[model samples]
Target: MKIKLLVVGNTTDSLLKSLILNYKKRIKRYVNFEITELNIFKFRKIILTFSNQIIRLFIVEQLYRDFTIINNHPCHNQ
Candidate 1:
């Protein structure tokens, strides 16, 4: 399965961006990972447009702080 990360805001800190990019690259080796960054306004627009799909699972960053753990999951290898 493909994972799409929808970030509502951009990270202005270069160090943070670099860290995120590094993790993204590592995650890509195990699964089809993607990160989509959108400003607050655009994110709000999307929320309004896709209100019907509100039931979908939305994993917040705080909950998945260590996303790299996916590399250890055997199911993702498929």
Candidate 2:
């Protein structure tokens, strides 16, 4: 089985990437795990239009899990 993670923005921080990679490596021990980072700068235009299909593909490809994590910030609105 293949597990794919579609991250919305490019991770510019090295520390963040390292942490994510560490988790991904741990996940790989039990399954085929992969991360696909979609850069907002490069794909911002197409993302809005293609987002639906992208999610659909993710679900159709294998067992689906959607986890959204949001950090609290002074200016953040949710």
Candidate 3:
């Protein structure tokens, strides 16, 4: 069974990033998932503003420790 992990968000917080990494590590055993930015248009920001929360919830509700979204980047060791 292939599950897609979509870590869609538009924030740049360190805690959020760490969570994403943790999600990735936990979901690599089931499907190919990665982190991706929610591409909301300039004018459509209003629509996507509250929608991101729904997306996040959906990810949490349906995702397991074996799914990936497929946009992950390497963390810097600086």
- For model 1, the stretches where C-alpha displacement exceeds 4 angstroms are 40-78
* Superposed Cα deviation of residue 4, candidate 3 (Å): 4.1
Winner by TM-score between candidate 3 and candidate 2: 2
TM-score of 1: 0.53
Q: Give the winner by TM-score.
A: 1
Indicate the TM-score of model 3. Answer: 0.45
Better of 1 and 3 by TM-score: 1
Minimal lDDT window, size 10, model 2: 64-73
TM-score of each predicted structure versus truth: 0.53, 0.49, 0.45
Best by lDDT: 1
Q: Which pairs clash in the backbone of model 2?
A: none
CA lDDT of every candidate: 0.52, 0.50, 0.50
How big is the RMSD of model 2? 11.5
lDDT tens digits, residue span 1-78, model 2? 687777665555555556556656645655687888666577344433344434434442223222112222222123
